[model samples]
Target: MGGSEKHAGLNNTKLTERLETAFPLLFASIGCIYLSVKIFNPHLKNKTKACIVIPTVDDLILFASHRAQIAQYRELEITVAGLAEASLFTSQKFYLNQNSHINKNLYTTVISFGDTKWNTQQKSKTSLRKYKINDERATHNYSIITKILKPRYKIVKETRNQKGKIKNPEYSYISIPISKELFCDNLTNGKPFYTDFYKLAVPNRDKSGKLKYRIKFEQKELNEMIEKINFDYEAEKIFIKACHTAWKHRLGKLGSDSKKPGASSFDKLVARDFERLRVALSKSKNFESFRETITDFWSRAGRIQELTDGWEKVMILLEPENWKRGRDLALLALVSYKPKNEKEETALKKLEFDDTKGEEDE
Candidate 1:
């Protein structure tokens, strides 16, 4: 009798423990049912903001993975928008190819501008409003949303100008904020796009080939690859470092380091080339003599209308003088149209001598 009682007590205790462990789960299941009914039944309205994200198709897929927890929130609704033209990769076709881990039932809308197709499109005027706002303020709010939601993978820079003006510069830098727990394993591996052992096992091309390099994956292969690329914090950090290095090389410096002289970058070479043109123009005597020559030619005998018609060409022929300002010479030349003979040239020379002689007498 004592043994029987002891065994019965042990069994009861185990049963109670199991029920206790399962109670929370049971309650959660009921709550989930209630929420689902409320969401689709048109009876319960969404209490939270309807998240409208504009993302290219590929980025939308990547963002969806990080949003698994958010999707679980019954109150939240996720909408992905894209433009048809700009977003070549992000489309219904591409999305269909990739199995979504977050909000599998999410909706995608493509916005078209004129005849052009865009990658992401949103019905809400929120983005338009943002663009109308002061750029700095708009970018700041956008960045905050991105950090919290990590939706569209847009980068916003908080920058200061030479005059100490603070501004937020927008960028298309791809970044996703993922939960630490979900990403930890991959984060240690330093590959954001590696999702599977097979993807890791795939051979990479070491040299150039006539055909482009591509990794062909079906549904099963894609599933594995997506998992491999999901990066954790450490992996993100490494990727960021690499991005920073590349950005530095591409856009960090404008010209050669000022400390190093005679070492020219592309920008420096361009500046030097422009300077040479300026010097050549400055030294050209054609410009200096332009006005005087035009005036003298007019005084001699040139048609004013003809001179006006061929002003530019005449100026070029009259070199040095074209550089001088005003159309005084050009005008006179055009008005005076008589062909100069040797006698006329001699008379003009004599008249010039007589004027000098008169000045001497004075």
Candidate 2:
């Protein structure tokens, strides 16, 4: 269906480190903090907080094999991202030609991996197996989703690496995002939308062949059923780790280590980050002082935003001059915005005039 590709709450990595460290900080003081925000923030007010994660190796396996389960949840649009994985092999020209025949959306994207110093390390014996690249199923699915959603596929590797033992966490890092409109309305020729996934009540007949009043469904009602979530920097990492852990948990729960998504795995992921951060300082003996606050941030990953918005907020709270500047910058987001039409422009001008007058009076 042709509509919109509204994406939000995206956090992807494009970072570098000069020296090797055991653990990475959100704002690694080791190297000057390379903080950049590009068209992403999960701060949509008065909406439910939830992440719509799609990429994970195990998920790709189930998605490819479990045709029945997929059909069961077809209405949820959870599998719309599956389209990304499936289209990996097709060519853009082939997709265009094929879609011309059927009313389907498809696009071909070539698979290529650019080698960076960080993601690769020299080893004496072992084949240069990529660290984050999982089984073939996962690799395939990742290709598909990245093509469709267009999220930043981040892989920040250390500037230097161990000669024999290269740390390969890059393969584990998959920043998953899929288009919302790609999963929503006009799909399947108005068959069923994500808004129609859960049935509140199945229509029933009262012992007669007559009919009962039908409760009509409205597409607008699904607006609040959001796809993205609001999370601070610390929370973002913790959230991603939690999701991966849940998926790796035994889906069957049949064996000891069989994986599935659930609350138990979520708890373990949080606890793991807590202890890891405490020991993260041990990466470098001298940097302990700098790592302390960041360690505390991860310890209370659940309450990061509740405590502070970003590092800027943390600095503002600790200083006087910074606080004044922070207040001025806060007003910038309020005062700076583009209006779509003259009606909005006039309203904005009046508000600006009133704001200027109030500021002068102050």
- Best-fitting candidate, measured by lDDT? 1
Q: Top TM-score: which candidate number?
A: 2
Worst 10 residues of 2 by lDDT: 32-41
Candidate 2: residue pairs that collide: 84-144, 132-171, 132-172, 249-259, 249-260, 250-258, 250-259, 250-260, 251-259, 251-260
Error of 1 at 2 (Å): 85
TM-score of each: 0.16, 0.17
Model 2 Cα displacement at 299 (Å)? 42
Question: What local lDDT does model 2 show for residue 41?
Answer: 15
For model 1, residues 1-362, the per-residue Cα lDDT tens digits are 12333356344453233677666555432221111101111111122112222332335445455344444643222221122111111222223333422223333332222111231222122211010111222222222222332223455777888987887665653322222111222222232222222221122332342221122212222323223332233323232222223222322232334236666654444334323322232223455444454354244332344444444444443444323222222221111212134432232222111222121210
**In model 2, what is the error at residue 229, expressed in angstroms?**
22
List per-prediction Cα lDDT, in the order shown: 0.28, 0.27
lDDT of candidate 2 over 1-362, digit per residue (tens): 00111122225633444444425343222211111111111222112112121222223333344433333442223222222222321211122222233113322221212223342421111111112211233222233333434423456774436575565543423333322222222122222122222121122222453222111121112212212222223432232333222222211122222245543442343333322432232222233332353344334334344334344434432243323222222121112223334533343333211222121210
lDDT of 2 at 293: 38
Candidate 1's C-alpha runs over 4 A off are: 1-81, 84-113, 116-233, 242-258, 265-362
